[model samples]
Target: MVPVAPTVLFLINEHIATEALLGEAFTDHGFDVETFEVVPAERAEDPAGHVTFPDPAGYDVIAPLGATWPVYEPALRDTWVGDEMQLMRDAAAGGTALLGVCFGGQLLAQTFGGSVARSPRPEIGWCEVTSDRSDIVPGGPWFQWHFDRWSLPPGATELARTADSSQAFVLGRALALQFHPEVDTELLKVWLAADSNGEALQAGITHDELLTRTEELAVDTAARVRRLVAGFLTYLAGQPRPS
Candidate 1:
């Protein structure tokens, strides 16, 4: 009998970015991919009124991707962040692997007894990180676009970091990251096009410069993502899920 391949559920919060290269990495790892947009485009500002999520334990891996909104904003916390945290907690309790990115990492941090707040300085464009666990998270010129940062959660081992904040951590079977390893030139174009708030420009990174950097690092970043996903599945997924 043919075995059922493992599956992944990638939550696309606020439509800030799609799975892009992340989805491709999962597919290459032999997992079926499901990208779900938890926040509706029309109601992104008010996602509290109507949002529903499936059982996180239903998939082998669940990724809460990056987002435009902060997880700690009072309005967001009241409407959806609180509920999503609960779901992630439940998923952790039930042996489902989690991979959190940026805002998603912030969510995991809060769910696991850490906190999120404004960063001293925004990290935009491509920057190199320092990773202790080079086997899992490579020190990279990874894409980063965030104004907030996460404190390392309890019982989490920080695998990577920059001067500003924790770049990557592992809480049981979950891996949380502050950088965007999924970004490629095409995906970055989408993110840059949606620069309604001039976030990148304000951070001192021009669109052209970031795009150029992204294109230059495309091959290496893609290889890094594949290695990351492979390392996560081979090593972390074998352990018990986060509680």
Candidate 2:
């Protein structure tokens, strides 16, 4: 009998950037991917209402995606966000590999006794990241749309950084990135439409410009994500399992 592919559970915080590009990469690498929308559209009126999460121990991998809400908000910490953090901590303790992106990365840091706070300047749009380990986590003009940043977790190795913030880090079987490598043009359009706070406008970001940039970097971004996922899998393989 053919063995089942390793399962990856994506903890999607909102509808903005669903696992569009990254999900495809996981499937290509022989893993079955499933997403749990923490805040479904039906619950849009009350985002934190009646949320539920799956058992992290059941999956071989867990990836928490980005969210609109800030990770340090007291109200969120009192609700589903707190619950999600506990889930992440438990998953990590159980040796499940984690891939955190954007807000998700912040979650990983916060759960593992690191700190997350407002950046000196919010990083939006494409920006180049510097990495010593370029072959694994390449330096890039990568997509970034976040207002907050995280300090490295205890015992985590800093892999990449930009002038403004630490861009990526790894600990055990987990890897976290401050940028949205999972995003595609379609996802960017949704994010632009949902910008109720005029964040993009204030940052001088227009839909046409973002869309055009995404179109221009489509091939490169996809290739980068593929390499990132491949590197993550390699990293996970090298981690010692809890005995």
Q: CA lDDT of each candidate?
A: 0.87, 0.87
Q: Write the per-residue lDDT of candidate 2 for residues 3-116, one digit (tens) a residue.
A: 988899988898776998999999999999999988877766667644568988789889999987888988788788899988988898888889999999999999998999
TM-score of each: 0.96, 0.95
Candidate 2: the clashing residue pairs are none
Give per-candidate clash totals.
0, 0
Q: Which parts of model 2 are misplaced by more than 4 Å?
A: 237-240
Candidate 1 clash pair list: none
Tens-digit lDDT track of model 1 for 113-182? 9999999999998878999988889887788999999988879999998888889999888999999988
> Which window of ten consecutive residues has the lowest lDDT sum in model 1?
43-52
The 10-residue segment of model 2 with minimum total lDDT is 43-52
